[model samples]
Target: MTPLLTYLAKVVIVSGILYGYYYLALRNNRFHQWNRYYLLFCAILSLIVPLLRIPLQFAPEETSNSYTGQVLLLREQVFTPAAAAEAGRTDWAFVLYSLVALLCVARVAWGYWKILRLIRHSRLEFIRPYWLVLSDKIGAPFSFFRYIFWNSDSRFETPEYRKIFRHEMVHVQERHSNDKLFMEAVTALCWVNPFFHLMKAELALIHEFIADKKAVAGGDVAEYAQSILQMALQSRHDFQLTNNFSHHPIKRRILMLTASRRLRFSYLRRLLILPLAAIIFCSLAFVVQEQQVETRAAQTAPADTIKPPPPPAPPRPNAKPAKPVFDSGGNEVFTFVEIPPSFPGGEAELAKYLSTNIRYPKEAVDKNLSGTVFVSFIVSAKGKIDSVRTVGTKKGGGLEEEAIRVVKEMPDWRPGKQNGRQVAVMFNLPIRFTLAKPEKKGPDGVYTRPEKMPSYTGGEGELHQHLRSNIRYPKEALDKRVNGTVLVSFVVMPDGSLKDVKPAGDKVLGSGLEEEAVRIVNIMPAWEPGREKGEAIATRMVLPIRFSFQ
Candidate 1:
């Protein structure tokens, strides 16, 4: 699911739970005095957990695929009997099922642990007049019990204290402890729902409002405020389960209590109906998402069914040169061809440049534009860049414009050359707009570019002779069982020399192939390196050396 949708779903689920809590609380009284913010915070955390969990679910499988695709294939092969013993075992589906099961177990265990801790800390305290109260020593209600009255050394005869006591009494008489336990349990279970915490907070607030109204209906508000302040000052942490007469934030409680309005039963009834509607809608949305995912998977099955093409054949060491080649053949072939390199720079440089030059077209930034744009074109024979196109990953006009504009301003390249002349070659580049780590700076504050190397000017016949004499293929590659290409990039220096031999492409062809190609290239008979403006400077080049069995 998209991040936006993921967030929305979390919000809705949490909200529903809160609304449910509020509805139930209202059933007891119209003006209850409680701290709603506390509950809201709890629900918010719960919501975030589940949303974050969704992405992590696929992490193990993705890592496995990246680290060892062969292992995954092997698992699929060896476990066929057991897999066949079960039903429905598509790779992705199996992975998803495992993820879901893991998440469920983790979430349940975490939630149970949290609630258990809360219950333990809220040791039940039996007090006077056959009343029970749960307190965390912060004057907040830990559970339902009789009205608790303890603040200062001196017992106050204030009307506010009386009202507060009455509020606690209401909680005790109505078994508010049980209701709270239920609410917390639900909130814990739905921790991934941001709205859950919000709803819980709302419920607590409404509950407070109801109790406050009942207390103030017959007396003075000023006295109640004074009593709350006094109790708060003298509150002790020793109380655990006893319901406290003095709860804070006292100001919020007072405001809620004073605003409490006697509403008709019909109003609450209407609210109940709305929650039912919301629940149904959310359920439907979830179901639709599931169906869409299944449909997409079905559509993708055919595409994946197209087995990977057999790896390309390795170039023969002593074979005749292929005709119809772009560059010259025997006596004119180059051991190395150089292509100019370009970089937008390290993170800091990019940030600095963007800060000063990136105008982000206010509209695009306002709309929060983000995407990866793939720009592919050719570097001309003379190293000039052209045909820059922006293919958007998401539908954002401004983002495309910014990307295209930036690409157009890129510095000219020292075009790719082959044999003794330049040649146009296709290049693919990906530009991404994302929050990433800053580039690291070395001690001396120097940014080093890859060193340039010389190019070769020799015939294909000479190239073959050199390769046959020096190349040493890995045992595996020579075994004719591995069919893969090794793309190597090395420098051919000014005076018929090879330096900085390296692999410039995929490693799937096997690291062995790459090393063999590099070794052969390094020892090959050198060619005259390409020159620029009568000066022979080091050049950069890429070469694809392939190995195959058939």
Candidate 2:
């Protein structure tokens, strides 16, 4: 959802920048054809730029006095469940957006339907390479593709009629209907954005300016301006897909018609769009690339360095203990130690310390930014916490800085011992900052829905690892070569323990697959309970476990 929001924001930004540039640099220019193509190209580019994934290199900033540990351990994990029949959740926002867009589409279709109805009843006359449809329903002259609709009562022999026909003819010859149709589709898709409507209007105005110029070529500009004003007083059809002769700003059209032609060199202003587009593309792609690089670096670096050092031999029980050794990076490395480090009071105390000390940033709270921040640090041989830094920031809004600050302020722990000697050990902790309070509840006593769902102790990755390690393929199902996904439903209790674990559907995956899946889930470790508001709640979840023969 965050990535989708980011992509949409980029689309808006790119479109805004391109349209702004067009208004400033090329709006009043005499090169109508060039401006028309420029606008179309920009619209296409804005849609394409957000989908590009470009790799970029940036020098990571170094924190003061922070030594790089040989192994990186922290990571941010988000759980997004696959679509399931049991969840049956309706995304109301998406439904509303789709409904509005559909309304716009139906509105545009109605306009075309009106035009087609008029064509069916009117008399169609062949006029050179165009078809002139004479209809009483059309109050004014309009061109749709190669067909031009003129009022049946109009005086075709008059000079004013000739001028109007010529203007409509220019639209048909230029195929301006294609541009109208393109913008109509854009309007249907982006009806929520006012700028898109403005863009459509601007494109239409540009079309009029170009057609008006070509209509009066080698003739008097004042006469063409007069024809446009006279036609503006008459009624016009309200179809979106057609180019009506009087559908644009009369003053702008007249001014553009009489305005001095721009110098050829002035057309060079269109080239500015190249740099504008490149800047927008880079701005959108750089932020996404930076985040990807940070996540990849955190996961891959330390694991690559810590590749299972050979296990140390057991020390003699009666002999004096040997001191631990330091790696070339000046950080202590441990493979097999006599005793691992412990927090001041064990896991419960560590939890108490985090809950009591962690403060949610006001900025983050105001913006409703919530996610887990993974902080990695070292407990030195002297039991002091040092080298505090954030390895993974799932969602940034000063959350990472707050998490790092809280971790750095933590008291010293009991350092690990290797053969009775204190040794430094790397520690990773994930601190979740949520704005939800536990007191909030829906209509139901139990929270059927929550802002944040329950997860495993470490993260979703660890949950998968636990499942893979614990789940045993049933011999009956394996021997019969039965393979299918079994949906298991369970309630994650307020205390983060599983309850009511059972298969959602009866005998759905035969051969004991469903039974085996339910058994595996019941034996799983307690999860970090899901929360609604700020309070813990029992949330029901359904997971699909697959059984297959190797």
Worst 10-residue lDDT window for candidate 2 reads 300-309
Query: Model 2 — TM-score against the truth?
Result: 0.52
Output the lDDT of residue 390, model 2: 78
Model 1 lDDT on a 0 to 1 scale: 0.43
Question: Residue 250 of model 1: what lDDT?
Answer: 68
Per-residue lDDT of 392-472 in model 1, one digit per residue for the tens?
A: 255474655665665566555444344335555444444444322222222433211112223234433344334434444
TM-score for each model: 0.31, 0.52
User: Model 2, 1-550: lDDT tens per residue?
Assistant: 4334566677777788888888878887788898888877767776778886554423222211111112323232221111111124565766787899999999999998998998899999997788999987788799999899988989879877787888888899999999889888887976765666777888888889888887888888888788888788977658879998987688999989888875665846877677777777777655321211011111111121111112223334663433444533476655223344566544444655565555666677678787667687777887888777776435787888877887789788767665567777665665655565323234556554466667668754455455545665565554455555565777788998998888774447687767777877798889888787787888776664544321
lDDT scores of the candidates, listed in order: 0.43, 0.66
Best by TM-score: 2
